[model samples]
Target chain A: MPTPEAWAESFTEATNGDAEIGAHGKYYSCSYMLDMQERKLIVDMHRGRVENINLDVQPLDAYEFALRAPADTWRGMGEPVPKPMYHGIWAAAFRKNLSMEGDLLVLMQNLRCFTRQIEILRETGVPV
Target chain B: MPANGRFSPVTGRYVTIDLEDPDLGGEYKVFFLENGEGRPLVCQHTAGCHNHQWRGLLEDPDITRSHRVIAYDLPRHGKSDPPNDREWWKEEYRLTADFFTKFVVALCDALELEDPIFMGSSFGGNVALQLAWRYPDRFGAVIPVEAADYSPGFFLDWWQHPHANAAQVCASGTWDLMAPQSPDQERWKTWFYYTQGSEAFRGDLSFYSVDHDLRDKLEEIDGERCPVIMMTGTYDYLTTPEMTAATAARIKGAEFIEMQDIGHFPMSENYPVFKGYLEQALQRIEERIGATVSGQR
Candidate 1:
């Protein structure tokens, strides 16, 4: 029952806090943060410009990206295909933290990270 | 005896097959053909198409002798009246499915049919699959011809198809022929065409849009009591034989047949060939039902 927004927030928190960034500043990429309910992706750029990277438009799953990426970078690189913006970050963040439904707090953070990645992609015009 | 008296009592006169959902209210006519001594076969017409599509098989002397044929019109098409209500029209595809499911069940209940074989083409084919999936026990056999698996993306893709012809049908309020020439006919055509253009159509399509993969379900159905057969035309622009074959492969014992040199409307395009296929299909149906061509119980 977590709203799409709350799910996004938790997604952002998980990615931002994780410490195991790959050697090339790569981090665990997912179409959606585990916290997000509806298959929305979240990614941590290792402090890279949040406003510059573009997400792919074609939806992809973790398994699919794993198959496409080179062996060494596969785990760290996000999905090969891009996905559409599942939920906007601002709406998700506000609802997750303020709403009575605290269970979705974690998911909202993840959605935040997901939306941020999308925003970055839109700015830079590069596929995520 | 009068020509009217020739009609069988079990066949019943043409009456509206009422749907449970008031939103799907409409009038339909059903003609039941009795084979010497027994109940009849129920043949449902494709939506936006007429019984004439099946004239070839119905008129075939050989096939006619073996099984009874009952052909009826869907709402707002042919002789049937549009449902008085309009809400269902807003969600045409799902409503159509619901209406069809209810209509078939009601027809069986009214006619006191034990278990009847279902024959459908195009949209009728989709209805047959749905009926089989939901009420497997009620059906003895299922024949779905050129039935496209419904999905949200499927409708979008269909709209995008180079030969959709939907827009033409919508604007003209009739399939190229203008066979229904009366004012009432034109009104019915417009209503029917517009329903196909509803957002509900898109939503219904999305609801079933699971990558066009029904192999698991079909396999389960195939293993069940009844037999399922899928037929398609070689030259069908819509619902090609390849698609039908993929659907059939999933069902363990399902039969797949592809008619040669035929198009989307095979029953109309090549009646003789269509009738031949039906003759073979009916033979298989009889074998599965354990009933003779006479249609005894």
Candidate 2:
């Protein structure tokens, strides 16, 4: 497992460097959380670029939506070659205990870009 | 035929037909792509999608050589429009199983097809089951791909929610439905098709995730007569192989084929891989139909 600081750096760099997001995420501004059982992260984006990545998330931290799952689930998603059902949040949620909490409408609004951002986890890897 | 250009055997046409549903008799100008020359093989797309999902099957020279493949856009999908005579926008679009089944039958009837083989994926798959149950004597065989007896939890508001770009939400939302092993080009093409059908996607699911249920109706379907052959991809979490197998178990003579390394939209996402399983399915259907032949059926 990578350190939280290391994961944050890779995730931010990967997200910012993504071409698909850059092309299609003109309005993909939103705040979302990745609630891995062992750690939590709030990633804020503005026009497809990562505005900030809060590695040290507080209980008071806010996000429009959050993807919550066990560490194993996050680990599977973080893998470069995730097995079937762990390839995406929807896949994980349907077959595993991964849950999408909070305002899902906002999540759906930015679904296209957010989906790509999550895929970058494959390269960045999870902190847990 | 010309420099830097190639010609495809597949061609497109439009046909107008009256809906056969008892309560709805509206007319529809349906569009379809066709090729080949044998017993009719009618293809249906998944919910919110069009007949283009069968592009791979439509142009396959082997299948086209023996079977006349016809992939049609169920009204309001692709080139098919909504009820032409009614104020369609006045009412919310929620497809009923009765309407969907009748529509397919009417389309086939309009085309004057004889003993057609119906193959559909996702919601199209569910309707294949419905077609088998309701009109056993009509179709030669029904191949329901990535389907089960009951598939709920998909008919949601997110597809057409006002707060989101329905196109992106619908497209990206269903992104994971494909196996990661599929080529990015093919998967993106499927995604592009999805973007064009957000308006009809949720309504189509009305039949798929809501009205289509065959848990108790399976026995009523004489699979030996109509030859019901079901196939589900392993990566399809919505209708897993386990669910499909369980559904097949209850159907007296129906056969289930579990496709590996595929997902919900097999024909669209990964056609080459799906083609092998489809060939096996086609062979099984032929044997079953041959066994149950009564008179020229």
Where in model 2 is the C-alpha error above 4 Å? B291-297
Q: Highest DockQ among the candidates is held by which one?
A: 2
DockQ, all models: 0.01, 0.82
Residue-level lDDT tens digits of model 2 in A1-128: 88898888888888888999989889989999999988888989999899998988988999999999999999999898788889899989989999999999889988999998899988988999
Weakest lDDT window of 10 consecutive positions for candidate 1 chain B: B173-182
How far does residue B4 in candidate 1 sit from its true spot (Å)? Answer: 20
| Candidate with the greatest lDDT versus the true structure | 2
Tens digits of per-residue lDDT for model 1 on B98-120? 65677777777776666677877
Q: Please, what are the lDDT tens digits per residue for candidate 2 over residues B248-270?
A: 88887999999988899999999
Error of 1 at B181 (Å): 28
In model 2, pairs of residues that clash are none
Shift of residue B109 alpha carbon in model 1, Å = 2.5
Provide the DockQ value for model 2.
0.82
Model 1 lDDT per residue over A1-103, tens place = 2333443354344334433221212422332222222132333233322211122223442211111212122111222322211112221221122111222
